[model samples]
Structure formats: structure tokens, C-alpha cells
Target: MASLLAAVVSAVVLALSSMLSERHCAFGFGGFQCNDPVAGYGSVLLTATLASFAILIVSALIATWKLVAWFRAR
Candidate 1:
């Protein structure tokens, strides 16, 4: 339950960050909107979300495998 909840929260956080960053990009200006914080943030959020999910899945898999091994050994 807790793990599921964490995943849900992670997804939400990433989505929100992406959204806010997108807004910043749309409004911020430079020659080519080069001064935008939104575009950068959106990229960052995408990267972070990808990394976070990979880490979560790897850790969860390892933990579950360990648990099964532990119980089997007992």
C-alpha cells in the first residue's frame, strides 16, 4: 500500500513540475524564449521522473525477491 502510494505521489509531483515549468516557458521571453524557466524545468522533471521510476522499480524488485527468499529459507 505504501509503495503504491509513493508511486502515485511521485507521478503527481513530476506532472505538476512539468506543468508549472511549461507555463514558465510559455511566458518567459528571450530571443527564442531563451530566458524561460519552464522549458528547462519541464526537461528536468521528465528526467527526474524517469530516473525516479527506474530506481523505485529496481529497489522494489530487489526487496520483494529478498523477502521471498527469506521466507523460503525459514
Candidate 2:
């Protein structure tokens, strides 16, 4: 259950990041502008998405371990 929740949350974050990226930074002219709000926002989202993925991975590992233990006990 925890893993499932994590997976769903991670998927949502990924979708949001993709949507934001698609909506911004499309023009063929750029060179690392520090004052770009879109870039800053994107960076924050990227960090969040990465952290969510890490949580998802850990949850998955826990779920798998529990399942294996249950099967072994049965």
C-alpha cells in the first residue's frame, strides 16, 4: 500500500514536471539565464521529482521484502 501511494505520487510529480517543461523554454535562443523564473521553478520541480522517485524506490524495496517474508512464512 505504501509503495502504491508512492508510485502514484511520483507519477503525478513527473507529469507536472513534463507539463511545465513543455509550456516553457521552447524558443531556440537561450544561454543559462539566472533571472529566468521558469528555469528556477523547473529546477525546484526537478529536485522534488527526484526525491519522490527515491522515496518510491525505498517503498518498493520494503514492499518486496514484506512479500517475500510472507511467502516464506506460508
Candidate 3:
């Protein structure tokens, strides 16, 4: 149970960090418009979001597997 809670908290933190960083970007101007000469900002954000979600999913799956095993052991 503690592990599950920690996993959830970590996931929430990851999501919030991503959101805050994205908000700080200068691309808030009309519809994803980034004036920076750097390329792949959007792609980077997409990758981060996907990675975070994947971690959250894996954590949840592990928690579920643990719970099932514990129940079976009873």
C-alpha cells in the first residue's frame, strides 16, 4: 500500500512538473507558436509526457500484481 501511494504521488509530481515547464515556455502566443530557432520542442514535450504516462502505468500494473499475489497467498 505504501508503494502504491508513493507511485501515485510520483506520477502526480511528474505530471505537474511537465505542466509547469510547458507553461513557462514562450510559445503561449497563438496556438503552439514558438518563435525559438530550436527545433523539436513539441516533440520533446510529447516524449516527456508519454514517458511519464508509461511510468505511471507500469507502476500501477506492478501495484496491481502485488495486490493480487498477496490476496492469493491468503
Candidate 4:
């Protein structure tokens, strides 16, 4: 259940970042490169990327823990 929730949240985060990139740059987020960004664009993008990573890491950790627990129970 936790893993599923994490997956959903991570998807949402990525979508939001993509939308933000579209708004700020002519190129999309997948390009991963933006030239002549407005003031503070870099910082905002960095923060969003970091947050997405953090959520994914946590989700992985949770899933791993659950799997280990299940194995031990068996």
C-alpha cells in the first residue's frame, strides 16, 4: 500500500516539474537543459528534482523493507 502511494506521488511530482519546465523554457523537461532561464528558475527546478528523487528513494526503501519482512515471515 505504501509503495503504491509512493509511486503515485512520484508520478505527480514528475508531471508538475514537466509542466513547470514547459512554462519556463521552450524546451521540455526531458531535454534536461534550459538556456536563458528567468531569475530563480534554476533554483526552483533543482528543488523540484531533489524532492522527486527523495520521494523515489523513500519509496524504494519502503518496498524493500516490506519484501524483506515478507521473506522473514515465510
Q: Which candidate number maximizes lDDT?
A: 4
Q: Where is model 1 poorest over a 10-residue stretch in terms of lDDT?
A: 26-35
TM-score, ranked from best to worst:
2, 4, 3, 1
Better of 3 and 4 by lDDT: 4
Model 4: per-residue Cα lDDT at residue 44: 69
Full-model lDDT, candidate 3 = 0.66
Please provide, for model 3 over 1-74, each residue's C-alpha lDDT reduced to its tens digit, 9 standing for 90 to 100. 86688578768867864674466444555544332443336556555556777777888888999999999999
| lDDT tens per residue, model 1, 1-74 | 45555556665766765565455643334322313544445446556657766656765666677778879999
lDDT of 2 by residue, 4-59 (tens): 67777877777776566566634345532223457656556556657776876787
**Model 3 clash pairs?**
none
List where candidate 3 sits over 4 angstroms from the true fold. Answer: 1-6, 17-44
Each model's Cα RMSD? 6.0, 4.1, 5.2, 5.6
Q: What would the TM-scores of all predictions be?
A: 0.49, 0.58, 0.52, 0.52
Instruction: Give the C-alpha miss distance for residue 44 in model 3, angstroms.
Output: 5.4
- Weakest lDDT window of 10 consecutive positions for candidate 4: 31-40
